[model samples]
Target: MASATLFHDVQQILTAEHPDPFRVLGMHTVSLGGELRLVVRTFQPGATAVSVTDEEGAEVAVMECGHEAGFFEAILPRGTSAFPYQLQVTWPEAGEPALMGDAFAFGPQIGEFDLYLMAEGTHLRLWDVLGAHPMTIDGVQGVHFGVWAPGARRVSVVGEFNLWDGRRHPMRLHPAQGVWEIFIPGVQDESLYRYEILPHQGSAFLKSDPLAFTAEVRPATASKVADLTKYEWNDAEWMRSRQEGDWCNRPMSIYEVHPGSWKRVPGEDDRPLTWREMAVDLVDYVADMGFTHVEFLPVMEHPYDPSWGYQVTGYFAPTSRFGGPDDFRYLVDALHQRGIGVILDWVPAHFPKDAFALRRFDGSALYEHADPRQGEHPEWGTLIFNFGRNEVRNFLISNALFWLDEYHADGLRVDAVASMLYLDYSRGPGQWVPNQYGGRENLEAVAFLQQLNTTVRDRHPGALMIAEESTAWPGVTQLAHLGGLGFHLKWNMGWMHDNLSFMSEQAIHRKYHFNLLTFSLMYAFSEKYVLPLSHDEVVHLKGSLMGKMPGDAWQKAANLRLMLGMMWGHPGKKLLFMGGEIGQWGEWNENRSLDWHLLADPLNAGVQRWMRDLNALYKREPAFWETDFSHEGFEWVDFRDVEQSVLSFVRRGGESGHELLFVCNFTPVPRYAYHVGAPSAGRWREVLNSDAEPYGGSNVGNGGVTETVPLAVHGREQALPLTLPPLGILILQRED
Candidate 1:
């Protein structure tokens, strides 16, 4: 299959890396045929996929790439871009496609060189921030509106702007380059507009610059209007939750929740919660659960229909999904009441259709950028704010602070940190640009993130800032002073990835990869981390955590126990999505609420009980908390005959704290008197058991045996013999 709609004459973002044969990234011209039709694409390589969108004021186009399109062959034609959209190659057997840095787009253009690697940069200035209106006091006219398309034949800046007609709106076209540029000196405060690209150079289509700061609807769509702003938040002075000391990267038994679907009782009228109503109910639940914190998917104002709340239309307003802006404030306050911090999943990475929001809140390049080459997120058609512009920087920075300070959120889990770091984060080479200074171009985004962390921390000491970074962009979770991104905590994505991979494999093969269980301990070397069973795993393609396991009900139970045991014992913060505790049976649907009824059954109920006990044990045991123990606490006692499916480890508390040893049998048969190495010689007590019949596990073992059992070993102190059951976790404590 080939790309039916082809692109031509593509160009690249100029940089100093290569003076000649400049690599081509994107094109300067996009041809959206008459009726201003929308173009879309979906990048689905699995049963489920990540489909990007496009939104510019009144004009919009969204299309999903089908899973049937074959792995890389499924380009849903996202939206028209100004560059040569690279061809995505698919590999079904590999599970996913590799980033083949090749240039492919809508037009006939070739990249002159490799670009994603070249480090190009520039000094950040004031114009990049959002909501920044130029001060024309006394006559110093700063940056103004422009009717420009350097790559087009003719253009005009139109909106609730300089009149509807093309009157004072004519943009000048540089014939030599077949483009246009016109600046309106007097335009500044309170404005919204978009560039209308004319059919130039043998083209018969109208285009919307993906980088337009303000967009307007030109008919033939469900929405078309210039957006302005009107919002009033009273929580600006709220102090964020603690970030350091007692609260710094502690056990994060996060109750991952999607506000829209958390309590939605299937047929009920969409789980309605009045601000005060939810506050009263939810705060009680968090405190009772023993979880340290709670994470809410993008709570900032967004279009309500979106299930995951990923498509944000209002960056500053809290979603009216459940209630109003102040209602969200009440929700945060409720969390604080329970001694639990709330984490807001921020979407600074993109925005949806809310012309009344960011669509050119001011004049040209007010909230975004003037050129698609700089302001567009190619994959997610949403208008990507120009992180390089001063005003745009301020807009995003201030937006971040607004949630932290006003809403009193303890922290923010910045979405898509990978996108913010790389110039061509997901693009094939030539699609990105750097400043005049020569660096990996999105330098402004990085700097702003640093500033955001620093500022948030300075304002509130214990303010925890976490990063959802998938890419190993060195120092992403490091402190700003160390020249890193300054996030207090980062998602241990490697663990999630490897663990999921291991869980998906048959138990017979899992033993061979025992290293995956303990290797992520390496994450402790950099910034603090949080092991999150995020919504990503269970909802779509990857399948629910339980569904990924390979075995019968009993084996599945054991598998879960093993995974949960490792998660709890691991050295890092911890979190769990809403229904994961009760063993949700269905896939995570963005539309429906969590399947709360699953808890009604004895089997699922058992999983929930085990989770509670784990949390209790984690808190009661000092080995689970405190930083000094990281280096000395966790050690794999045995992985011998990993192929047979057996693994064991002992976690010793630091500063002379209590010690606990955990052993597991991944195989299907029971093993008697398993030899596990222990650090001290003394009585060992069976403190916890995952084989409890209540949790859907067989009662194949004895627990609470408070008796002395010691063995001598040459290394440190000794090893001990303990009974083991297949697919079960046994916790023994040293009893002197």
Candidate 2:
């Protein structure tokens, strides 16, 4: 080689501006005189001397410093083919010499098929290809790091091993896939890392791995390399049955929890419970409460505690606040083993503007829209995802599958769906861009959601894709092939709003607001629904469920019992927030425990008891859930008793004529001899009475049973005269 060209190469390496370091730095066969020889080259920033050694620890040759900034090179003896080698270096003041493998010597670790699919944005198992994976290549074990930074001029894997220097480990770019990757030998598990991206047009910065499986705790934003395959899962039985079973007709009573506040270490400054602690405490609590499933608020890693994990930074990582990835896996496995399903709140709607996260990643609007009108969420001060971009869509869709496949989550309760559905959501005029067809609907987002649901369900049968959509977007829970959004269930936000509004009013005003109680029936069967009294209703000073009622303390408790009874009897699946069962008086606070001391009072304990009993009855009674989504399962015995603030309905299970009559009295005034139509003319037993003394209610109800007289009422063949308690709900089943 010529001296002038070698000197220029050395100058480029020193300046960290060389785009292709592999060609000049690694072992290469070059022509010397008339013979081909092996030349090994490397750049160590602070080394004074370097030597090359063969696989047998024999010193092959002493390397000469080609540049003052630590460029080293050595020529092997003639007639020798390339062999495995390592570099031994001595620093100016180090106690011992260091030996390490050449990072640039290894070829690209990502396969061609993976690169092709990644570029096409259809790599469903992107987690396998885009994160720090510990692997052994050519009998040498190391960590292979890969990240997509199409807009970056150069990208490097920075971590403690490299002194966080971008020039130390500049990645080899696969321009076909826009992914930069390198295999650093000797790098192993639990290594802290981030990508130092040099953008084509902006300043260089560091960003966390979007596909990290576990992350460091907040206030420290570094991605941790984890081996996720080591966990021994014990939910195989549950998984196999889940795929083959029908979940639609099943009774689903979900207990929504924010685990951080569900319980805390007593006298430990209210420290949140860890995943191991929750596996012991929270799992048993949910099981004992008779809930069929447990839904967690977003468990993904986030920066601000106040966001409660809604604004995600690490989409594939379980937050380290509780424990490692294995700890979360144990939590899910424990729940499934105990016959409880797990659902996660997934947020693909938006992400926070944390400088170290996805915002302006690669110094460009890569994951979000380039324009503020399409990218920014004004109300949340976050950034909306660019649903139109293929890679961005793949990121979200793959993330959804990751939770379901990796964590064994039974379902996803997609949050902020309404915002994603409409382009102008919470926006004033002229603040949003229109789609190609120029409608208010976000056409791209709609397509993304449809594809997401279809792919997830196709890959994992019986896995629920629920939408928390509040708007009247048609066919939210219908099949996508039939022009619907393809969700298995959707939260009945309208029902929650109207029911809570009606129950919050005074007794006299409730009669005037009777429509609020009956209005939801008009659309109850329109889609599969879950009546959610969720965390949203109890947070942000909206007040607790008990606090929302209008009355004295006793009336408040009684009103809460009636509300829960009515909710259970309603023609929809049920979901209640963590503290709702115990009549928590204060709004939910993420930082504090759930006022567990309230259970010491009988009134509060009674509410808890009522919830348990209600869950049992809901699960055991086919009439309540066996045909929930069909109109045939429900019949309005009478809903026109507005003058008395009363409602009556008959719920039927199957062709066997299994039926239960539900009668609710919203007023606090007891009524004697209230005649309600019965489905048949026989003995009707009062199976459940919410007004019973055990439930903190005035014990006025039918004494176990009532006889149906052969008198016509409400188009039925018989009528039963019954005593109705104040603020009461009664479930009566015929004993035929």
Candidate 3:
């Protein structure tokens, strides 16, 4: 190369502005006097002198300072070829000279095929290709770092290994793939790192790795190097059963919990329980409660506690707030071992505006829309993902699989799905952008969701993809190939809202608002549903389930038991947020533990007992779940008793001949002889009564048995004249 060109390249390396540092800063063959010669170049800013050494640590040649900024170069003896080498440097103030491998010495670590997949946005195992992965390259052990930053002038891996200096370890850019990578030998796991990106038009700034598997606890935003392959999981049986079992026909009673507030150590400043601790305490609690699964609010790394893990920053990491990534895996394994499935609340709807996160990454709207109308979320003060971008879609889809594949999560309850389905969500007219078809729908997001569901369904046969969508979007739980959203289940938000509203009305007014109680049946079988009494209803001063009920404390307790019974007996899967089962009076607070002391109160204890018994009975009876999404599973005997605020229904297990009758009395008034339709004409046993004394009710119900008379009623061949409890529910099954 010409002397002037060499000087300019050396200057670019010193200034950290070289787009491709590998070409000018590493060993290369150059022409000298019409003959090719091996030349080695390095940049060590603080070194007083530098020497090139062979693989055996023998000094090969003393390098001369090619620039005043500590640029060093050496010409090897003629006839030499490129071989393994290191730099031995002498510092004026350091006690000893440092010997280190040249970050630019290695060739591109990311394979061309992987790069092509990444560019195509079809890299299913993106985490494996992009991120700080500790591996052995060319007989040398080091950490290989890769990131996508197409618009950046330069990208460097800045970490403690390089004294957090971008100039020390500028990465090599693969121009065709828009990926930058460097294999920094001696960089080990648990080291903190960030990417220093020099945008095309502005100053350079450091951003956390988008594919970090573990991150520093909040209040510190650096990404930590983690080894995901080390965790030895012991849930083989659980995984196998999960893959083959038919989850839709099985009973799934989920106990939703917020890890940070579920329980806290009073003696330790009320800090939340760690993952290992929860592995024992929370696992035992959920198991004893008879819940089939435990759904955690997002456990992914997030900075704001108030957002309740909804505003995600780190997509691949399990939050370090509880413990390391493996600790979380241990918790999941523990749950699986206890015969409990785990569902993680995944938030791909939006992300916070933290500077160190994905915001304006690579000095462009790489992961989000550049236009505010399309990129911004007004209500959340967050940023919407640009689903149209292939790489962005890949990032999210890959993240969803990461939890299910790496963490062994049985399902993912996708959060704020309604926000992603529409372009004008939570927006007024003129505040949003329309798609190419000029419709309110977000076509890109819809396509992304369809692809996401299809990929998850194909990859994990039995794992669930549940949507927490609140809109009236058709076919949410239908098959994607049939023009549906392809969700295994969707939360029945309409049922929750209508029922809660009815339950809150006074007994006198409940009769007037009877439709609220029976209106859900009209569309209950439209989709596979999970009737969720989730955290959202209990937060933001919406009040706790207990507080939402009308009348005195006794009536409130009875009402809560009745509500729970209705939810379980309804033709849908169930999910109850923590604190609801215990009749907690206060709304949920993310900052503190649940009111555990409420268990001391008999009413609260009774509510808890009622929930446990309800779950036990629900799981034992396939009638409640076997034909959940089909009208065949549910038959309304009578919803016409509106004047008395009563409802009666029969749930049947198809072909199994298993049947259960659910009769609910919404008002606090006992009826001595209310005739209810029976499915058969034999002995019917009272399997569960919410009004039993054990559940803090008046105990007004049949004495464990009722005989059906041959009289016709509600088009059935038999009828049962039974005593109806006040504000209570009774579930009866035929003995013969």
> Is 1 or 3 the stronger prediction by TM-score?
3
Give lDDT: candidate 3, residue 617: 94
lDDT of 2 at 474: 99
Give the alpha carbon lDDT tens digit for every residue of 1-736 in model 2. 3678777877777766667777788899988887899999999999888898876557888898877888889888888888888888888889777888889889987899988877777889999988999988887788999998888888888998888888778889888668889999888799999999988776678999988888899889999999988999999999998998767788899999887888988788879999988998998988898999999999999988888889999999999999999999999999999999999999999999999989988888999999999999999999999998888998999999999999999999999999999999999999999888998999999999999999988999989999999999999988888899999999999999999999999998888898998899999999999999999999888999999998898899989999999999888889999999999999999988999999998889889999999999888888988888888999998988899988999999975557999999888899898889998889999999988888887789999999988888889889999999888899999996
Badly placed stretches (over 4 Å) of model 1 are 1-244, 270-275, 353-356, 360-363, 434-441, 706-716
**Which candidate model has the greater TM-score, 1 or 2?**
2
Score each candidate by Cα lDDT: 0.58, 0.90, 0.92
For candidate 3, write residues 1-736 as lDDT tens digits. Answer: 3588887888789899987789998899999989999999998887899999987778998998887778899999988878999889998888787888887788887899998988898999899999999998877778999999999999999998888989988998888878989899989899999999999998999999999998999989999999988999999999999988778999999999999999999999999999999999999999999999999999999999998999899999999999999999999999999999999999998998999999999999989889999999999899999998888889998998999899999999999999999999999999999889999999888899999999999999989999999989999988889988899999999999998998999988887898887888899888889999999999888999999999999989999999999989888999999999999999999999999998888899999999999999988888988998899898999988889888999999976879999999988889887889898888899999999998887789999999998788888888999999999999999996
Q: Which stretches of model 3 miss by more than 4 angstroms?
A: none
Can you give the TM-score per candidate against the true fold? 0.67, 0.98, 0.98
Best by lDDT: 3
Ranking by lDDT: 3, 2, 1
RMSDs, each prediction? 18.8, 1.3, 1.3
In model 2, how large is the Cα lDDT of residue 207?
94
Model 2: how far residue 461 lies from native, Å: 0.2
Clashes of 1: 59
